[model samples]
Each structure stands twice: as C-alpha cells, then as structure tokens.
Target chain A: SQTIHQWPATLVQPVGSPLSLECTVEGTSNPNLYWYRQAAGRGLQLLFYSVGIGQISSEVPQNLSASRPQDRQFILSSKKLLLSDSGFYLCAWSDYQETQYFGPGTRLLVL
Target chain B: QQQVKQSPQSLIVQKGGISIINCAYENTAFDYFPWYQQFPGKGPALLIAIRPDVSEKKEGRFTISFNKSAKQFSLHIMDSQPGDSATYFCAASTGSGGSNYKLTFGKGTLLTVNP
Candidate 1:
C-alpha cells in the first residue's frame, strides 16, 4: 500500500517569513505530484504539479513555488510569506492521471 | 472561468434521509468526473468517480449519475448517516494530453447529517 506523509501538520508564522512544506510518498515511483491550497470556504487552487524530477508546472502566479527533488519527494516553498498565503496546503499524487490521493495536509497561518 | 460548478453551498439532512449533490461542467472535453469528501481540517478523499462513457455508477451506498449530453453529474447518498457529514467537492478533468492532468474543483458543498 502507498502512503503519503506531510510534515509540520500545523504552523504559525509571521509575515515576510520563509515557508517550507514537505511531502513524500512511499511505495510509488514516477508518480504525478501536485500542490493545492484551500482557502476557508473556497475551492481548491492548484499551485504546482510535476511530472518528473526537476520539472514543475505552476498553475497560479503567486509567491509560492514547488519542486520535486526525488521521484516521490515534493516540496513547496516560499521566500517570503504573505497574509494571503495562509491556508490549508495539500499534496496529492496520481498514478496515470486517474484518481488522486491526498496527504494529511499542512495548515499554515500567517499572522 | 470555473470549469465545474456545484450547487447547494450547504445542505442539512436528517439521518436516514437521502443526500443529493449536483455538479455541472461547461467543457465538453472533460471526460472524468470525481467526487471527494473532506472532513474538517483533513484532506479531501476520493469517494466516487464516473466517466462520460457511463451513465451511472454505484459503489456501496454512494452513486454517481452522469449525463453526457447535459454535461452534468450528481452524487446520491442513500440512508445518510451522521458520519457522512462533511464537505463534498466535485471535480472534472480532461484526459487529452499535456497539462490536462490537473483536475478543476468546484466550490464544494457542506453536508451536515443530523443524528
């Protein structure tokens, strides 16, 4: 069975601070990884997706960026966080563009 | 442009009642439709999915009705329970090629099953 793990399940940061969220999947290789942000009472917004290592496609133009360092390791980072950047971030993986499996998610609050 | 649209921003149903959520899409190129259930503070989980080729698909107590020509689909929950209370999101995606791998999500519906 495949399992996805995310770190710092919850975080509180001040404005202009750096942000880093990690996502790793075990038991799968060369899987499609995606980064999504869900604002309160709003639909999910796709931030980034990667087909392979070093290849990242950004869906929205924002301060956040995503990188797939290893086959199953994806990271979402930001040089400086904004108040609008606060939301629940999710990491998902799909095997052939079929169903996507999401991680536990990281809740970030920028004060 | 929102590719997919879902109705009933919020729904309150008593236990043992039926819960229905409707979703519509404008893009004819979309071939895949999926419904996800999300609990508070948790990630959305794939509950059920249907393709354009199928008119309807049922899994356990959950069912997905797809109308190809109407470009609409819906989810039906039979004998709803309190555990079913959660936020439901409907999503659609095109399988063409390239960046089409991403799924466009709806605004989401908050379902509350009163016990």
Candidate 2:
C-alpha cells in the first residue's frame, strides 16, 4: 500500500514570510507529483508538477514553486507569502495509471 | 476554457433518497471519467470511475454513467446516507499515451444529506 505524508497539517504565516511545505510518498518510485490549490468552496487549481528530480512545470504563474529533490520527495516553497496564498494546498502523485492519491493537505492561512 | 462543466453547485437531499450529480465535457478526446468525494478540510478521494467504452460502472452505492456521444457523465448514489454528505467533483482525462492522465476537475457539488 502507498501512503502520502504532508506537513505541517496546518500553518499560520504572516504576510511576506517564507513558506515551505513538504510531501513524501512511500511504496512507489518515479511517480509524477503535482501541487494543487483549492479555493474555498471551489475546485482545484494546478500550481506545479514534477516529472523527475530537478524537473518542474508551473501550470499557473504565481509566487509558489515546486521541487523534486528525491524520487518520492516533493516540496512546495515560496520566498515571500502573499495574502492570496491562503488556501488548502494538496500534494498528489500517480504512477502509470495516473489515478492520483492525495495527501492529507496543508491548510495555510496568510494573515 | 473550462474542459468540464458540472451542475448543481450544491444539493440537499434527505436520508434514504437518491442523489444525482451531472457533469459535461467539451473535449471529446477524454476517454476516462472519475468522481471524487471530499470532506471538509480534507483531500478529495477517488470514489468511482468509468471508461468511455462502458455505459455505466457501479461500486457499492456509487455508480458512474458515461455517455460517450453526449460527452456527459453522471454519478448516482443509491439510498444516500448522512455519511455521503460532502463535496463531489467530476473529472475527465485522456489516456492516449501513458502520461496523458492529467485530470481536469469540475467546480464541485456540495451534497448535504439531511437527517
């Protein structure tokens, strides 16, 4: 069985502060990882995706960035947080089938 | 452009009643359809999925009915329970290649099951 771990489960950051969220998957290798932001009562907005180490694609232009340091470790970071960054951030991964399994999600609140 | 359009921004259903959510897509290239269920402050979980080749697929109380020509699909929950109350999203993706499974999700429907 595969599991995805993301932390911190919840965070409160002041405006213009640096931010980092980590996601790691177990029981799979070379999986495609994705970062998605969900607005309140809305659907997901794809932020970034990584096919492999050091390879990242920005689906939407914003302040956030993603990196794949290891085969199963993905990180979402921002040099300076924006008020608009407050939302639910989810990390997901898929194998050949692309049936994504999501993490518990990080609830970010930028005050 | 929105690849998928879902109806009923929110729905309220009484327990033991039927719950139906509909989704339509403009891209005919989509070959796979999936429905996800999400609770408050949690991630969306895959509930049921269907292929264009199949008209309908059912798992327990959840069923996905796909209409290829119509470019539409629907999820039906039988004997809905309070536990079924949550947000539902319908998504579509094409699997032409091994990596073409990038999902495009709908706005999502909030289903409220009243006791």
Lowest lDDT block of 10, candidate 2 chain B: B93-102
- lDDT tens digits by residue: candidate 1, B17-98: 9999999999888888999999999999999998899999999999999999888999999999999999999998885565
| Candidate 2: clashing residue pairs, number | 0
Query: In candidate 2, which residue ranges exceed 4 Å CA deviation?
Result: none
lDDT of 2 by residue, A29-63 (tens): 88899999998888988888888888899899988
Per-candidate interface DockQ score: 0.66, 0.73
Error of 2 at A75 (Å): 0.6
lDDT of 1 by residue, A1-109 (tens): 9999998899999999999999999998888899999999888999999989999999899999998889999999999999999999999998875788999999999
| Candidate 1 chain B weakest ten by summed lDDT | B93-102
Most DockQ-accurate candidate: 2
- What is the C-alpha local distance difference test score of candidate 1? 0.92
Q: For residues B31-71, could you state the per-residue lDDT of candidate 2 as single tens digits?
A: 77889999999999999988888999999999998888888
Question: What DockQ class does candidate 2 belong to?
Answer: medium
For this target, which candidate reaches the highest lDDT against the unseen true structure? 1
